[model samples]
Target: MKDVYITRISKFLPNAPVGNDEMESILGQINGKPSRAKRVVLRNNGIKERYYAINSQGEITHTNAELTKEAITKLFDDSFTQNNMELLCCGTSSPDQLLPSHAVMVHGLLANKNLEVNSASGICCAGMSSLKFGFLSVKSENSNNAVCTGSERSSTRMMASMFNEEAESLSSLEDQPIIAFKKEFLRWMLSDGAGAMLLENKKNETGLSLKIDWMEAYSFAYELETCMYSGGEKQEDGSIKPWTEYSSKQWLEDSIFSVKQDVKILEEHVISKGVESLEMVFEKYSKDPSDIDYFLPHISSNYFAEKLKTGIKEKGLKIPESSWFTNLSSVGNVGSASIYLMLEELVHSGRLKKGDKILLSVPESGRFSYAYAHLTVC
Candidate 1:
């Protein structure tokens, strides 16, 4: 067994930025209004702009495979086309289809591009899971070199008319119960992007950018109880039902094929239970929040910033607000890619000094899971 070092990271964003006001033209009028729900969602989440895998016409432009390919391409050296990677791990909130995994699809595209990688590709739970998978594989000597990717095309595949759509005969969007509850909240929180990182067992001669120190993860699924989820449906026999079986109209009405979250539950769970789990991680690593030089967290809402700060203080750790860095306010919540995007922003800022220790926390509401890790610049 050997330790892992993340040597290189690359990322990609689709098309241009989509501003808050511009969404009305793409999503059309909702509840007989020009996407007032979008405006409200922005107010709640504090998202300025997000990238979509679509043009102004709202047509599908890039698939999950393409989004990931862009980042993966930047990771490898052009002259070194033959893959040195022994494993390919992909984490995606929205895969192009339900059949083949997104990792395998990306593998196929790599072959077409004359970039041959013969490693097995496997899909894991999105968010920190894919990155951790790479770390473990290299640590266990399963692969000397591995590439991990996280991508999200959540916006492009969303069910049509996802928000308030006021028919001349129907009720206004505000008056619609389900729209006011589910659709409005999630519509603005997500963006499309992809991030990839290359991990190796051996450190470079110049030394790696970040040497993996410690990694840990935990789940509070029982306490959260479906705080956030997206997928098809469940039948009476507890069997899974295909999302396509339902009409697009039913998708919105039933809250199917969408991210449904209870905000109060999610927030409470994160602040209370989430922090408790995080503290255990700190104890496991024998490090305090003050020992960390940089703190990067992937949070969907800016509102949680203070809550997390308060929680850290209560745990007897004294991390400063100025030490925090993230791209969420600008890039929006990029699902599984958020953690990688935040790390990318930090490394590119040129503020990091030698021996600086950084801590990253990525919490995915998919099942109330959290992963925290410590890394140091060499």
Candidate 2:
């Protein structure tokens, strides 16, 4: 059993910004009162605030495929090109369209780099899945220089009139409490953003930085159809339209079962490779949870964060303030790019040193959990 290492990482976000109080205020106004909006405002999204790209009208700005291109360009220039890279991959949900797919477009944007570029799109977990593929690419002799970027233009997906109309209508009636709760939750929780990263096979001078270990990715085909977005229908305006509805309650329910199964699979496989228990995985691979120094969590809300915390406790792990990056409190959910954003902070801050192991975890999306080892502090 060999391990794959991550050489470099990077992230990108839209220019707009939003916070919890602002969200609360908006919902309060829409719902007609602060008291009325309380339940919707107090979920466990781990995000106290988040950013959104907006236009001159101050409405949420849509994710521009061009912006994603710019972010990836920046990442390559600033993060990994110097490693003498050979491959590129982009993880995203906001594609140029349903046909060519985002990856192929991004690959072309890089001027047909001749390196294999995968623009992968599969909801939230596409980011992690892309990385897993990149690692396997490196380990299996498919490619050595790999860069992965995960970005989303969720703002583009907002169904404003539909949302507001539904919100207002639901506010007026109490017919189906469950349905009402689900709709409201999705409206308030989903957000718009993007993030990117650069990876390479070459070890730097000191050789003490982040390294990838092992990645096991699985998707339950049975649950595939359970979550999806229908193709846009042709409109009288001669344009296609996407379904704006998001099933949050369905998503949450499906996620719990998916994550449990995925994690169980990863635990069983990795443990057999000598990475037993939460403690052994940390200690043998790098450091103990107690001495981990910091925890950069991929949390979307408080409810999600508490769920992760419970998972940590169940595994007998301890978390410290330094070990956690709570940006979700401000960034809503950046989807695929969440962990990379946190990793970028750790590196830029110079807090991470060569030889210090940073344990990274992703509990959602693909209903998967993976821990990677960043081996050095450079």
Estimated TM-score for each candidate: 0.87, 0.69
- For model 2, residues 298-318, the per-residue Cα lDDT tens digits are 554566555556566666667
Candidate with best TM-score: 1
Ten-residue region with minimum lDDT total, candidate 2: 254-263
**TM-score of candidate 1 to 2 decimals:** 0.87
What is the number of residue pairs that collide in model 2? 37
User: lDDT scores for all predictions?
Assistant: 0.73, 0.53
Candidate 1 per-residue C-alpha lDDT over 273-310 given as tens digits, one digit per residue, 9 for 90 to 100:
66787788887877867778899887888878778888
Query: Tell me, what's the RMSD of every candidate?
Result: 3.9, 8.4
